[model samples]
Target: MKTKITNLQPGMIVGEDIYNLKNSLNLKKGQKLDRDMIDLILKSDITEIEIMDSNASIGFIQKTFEELPNIIDETIYNKWIDSISDLFHHFTKEEIYVSLNNITEEIYKSLNVKEYFVLNFINSFGNDSLTYHSLNTAIIVSIIAKKIEIPYIMYKQTVKFSLIHDIGYAMLDDRVINDFDSDDKNALIHNIVAYKKLQDLKATLNHEILESILYHHERYDGKGKFHLKGEKIPPLVRITQVADAYTSLTELGYTPYQALSWILKKCGFIFDPYYVGLLYEITGYYPTGTKVKLSDGSIGIVLRRNEIEFFPEVLVNNEPVKTGPDSNVYIKEVIE
Candidate 1:
């Protein structure tokens, strides 16, 4: 039966896969409807959906909403990672662009009004492989794009650029690619190589996108590989640089809070202060998911940031505790 969202009720089963306006999957077929799921549907543009007949639950054991994971669809996410890995192994400009577009669409669906939860979920995990790193950086770039309120078209282009910004790394020797401190000359030329590889597709790609990938290695203080300093670097490229660095640092075992703190210390020396400020604004003083010790000698995970500067809601003993002027407890130190 086709039913309007207002008609949805608990225990109702989805008759077909439901997607959002961008064609990203929202709910899977056969999922038993719950209050939270109904609310999610209501929040989206989807007005009506197919629901299973009332007799469909012959042997069904409905799962509670709490049992469902609120993260991105794992199947889609893993497929995207594999798609990126395949692109690295076999380079095709057209196919790569299509894949990126699809991935961005899914990202939009995942982040819809769930920015804080989604961002915290992403920051809580880390992977050192190039494929995962590329995807992670792209997601971070998307978050920053949302924070800055860039035009939708430009946001898409920026995210696509980030998805393959390190394609040149795939061309390097395995040993060099794996060694973070590699002194080999090939390590220094990955950006140039990536630029040249994409240079042929200029008709399909804009100059800013290509240049952003090319000069991503350039530092703000005129000390990078090409020494292109300050405003000489493209604005989008500056954003990418910050995202790339933060992702890389976290992959190297730095917590999100630690990575942001490291980036803050660099300021204008290694990064543009303006862009760095934007990064801080989105992630807050202590990013969500960071484990910290409180003034009362209890450990808690940051739940979310509040209006207060340094205080965020924390989850301790399975209960939320707000830390700020009103609460006696406050975060004392990060748990590394």
Candidate 2:
């Protein structure tokens, strides 16, 4: 039975392969719909799904699912994932040097910025949080690059810097790294390790890029790993620092708004106030995919942020509501 997604009940079996608005298959046929799946579907902006009718033949539906490619495998999405994975794997190799510019151009040519953000929002809900965080930060770098209208060379360098900033963790034991908080001793060592590794690639790394990698964890107030204070931190490092923190917080189960709020609260002290402002322009008050509560106690998910800081297009009850001065609606808080 065709059913509105809101009407979907727990344990309701999916009748067919459920596709989102983009016609990308999300859930497969014969899978029993659960609360998490339903919520994910709604968050993805999928309005409806087919409910399984027990009286119908299961084989027919299964056959249909087999005929379609999984949404993650869709050409563009898969390519982006491959490119990110490839870059990540390169860090794991024993190569003494990597052509940073070559890798940057390869990824740049393979992705469309606008489409990449949408894909990131959709795919962030998946299991590979680490990879998504790296990619998300890189995408954010591009957005920041364009917004600041930096020279083309600097923009490319920023992308490369953000993407591999955490590659140092790749060399560490996952168990040990996860055992300690990011600010812990082991974690700090990994950052130093990654910085040194990049520094060793002197053939490709410049002083600026090397410092950004080494000092990305430096705080604006001087409480960071190396005790580098505000103004002492390099500009590129300051920008990537916020991007890394923002992505890490979100990956650790913080809602987008929750993460942004955390970043905002620490701005000027923990992060560069100027860069945080730039981040706000890119992510907005309510970033895309954040579930929010409105002034009137209604629940909604942010679709996109508009020119106004607080005002955004939200999906409330499956309807688009624009929040602005004209509308009485205001986002109360993020629904974590």
Candidate 3:
């Protein structure tokens, strides 16, 4: 069956090879379409393509899922939290690397259904423990990394670095760690301390990972701890900086919408505008798990982002409602 590009969905299978106007093959036959692939198709001049019939496409996706191994669940999520908490207590370089490696592998596996992963992560926010913050930052990095198609090895390195990005805080005094004033001299050294603490693991960890951890505080406009500015900072560090700040803000009681809004407001001055754009791409204007009220007086939780930025797919009264230009329903305001 031939379907217009606008009608394509994530689970549809290509029924034949698709060629561009220049007669170059774009999508191969039998390819199972994903959101990215659909977006690619939409961007190209191709307006229609042959896809498997609806019934067959549904069956194909169902069979593919049934054959695949189970991904993350609530039990595994708790275990990950416990493992991260344990890492803080044990505080060994070798153990930290091993645990983060395992956790990164599991996170990559869950990327196949990243929407669910993002939803689970947003809903899992808890008390402001170093453990929770570390894991939260890692999850956010994983989602961003996967969306941008960062290489597999580099993705693992970035996620691992995020998991231990603030390991230095564990070595600080209780007051310094708990209070956490950026302006305070004692609190500012945590980045340097973390860098030094990981020196012994240089043989095991990638150099980029270590460098990123050290410079994660570098602002895009040279106002950070070190005053390093703009392109002088490593790209990986810039990306991690945005994720770290957003996680910290949310931990400090900012709502998802508020945290993202703050980041957007600081773009170019505090964070790399390109990376900030990517964060918005992943989180949408109203990120997943945000409580909101609709124009029709119905309350709902944002389930996932849609092509439309302001109106996301929301779960209202046990049903998913996709709000967009064609729909009368829309999000009116975020609930506090």
Error of 2 at 43 (Å): 30
How accurate locally is residue 134 in candidate 2, as Cα lDDT from 0 to 100? 66
Residues 226-313, candidate 2: write the lDDT tens digits. 8899999877778787777776654433456767887888887888999999888776777776778989899987776777868887
Clashing pairs in 2: none
Tell me the whole-model lDDT of each prediction, alpha carbons only: 0.68, 0.63, 0.69
**Model 1 lDDT vs. the true structure?**
0.68
lDDT of 2 at 206: 72
TM-score for all predictions?
0.71, 0.67, 0.71
- Could you give me the TM-score of model 2 versus the true structure? 0.67
- lDDT by residue (tens digit), candidate 1, 236-331: 778877777777665434556777887888778778898898777666788766789999999987776677649888888778899987988889
lDDT value, residue 272 of candidate 3? 93
Indicate the worst ten consecutive residues by lDDT in candidate 2: 59-68
Expressed as tens digits, the lDDT of each residue in 21-96 for candidate 3 is 4422255455555554566578888889998764554211111112222224657767887888777666655656
Cα error, candidate 3, residue 119 (Å): 3.5
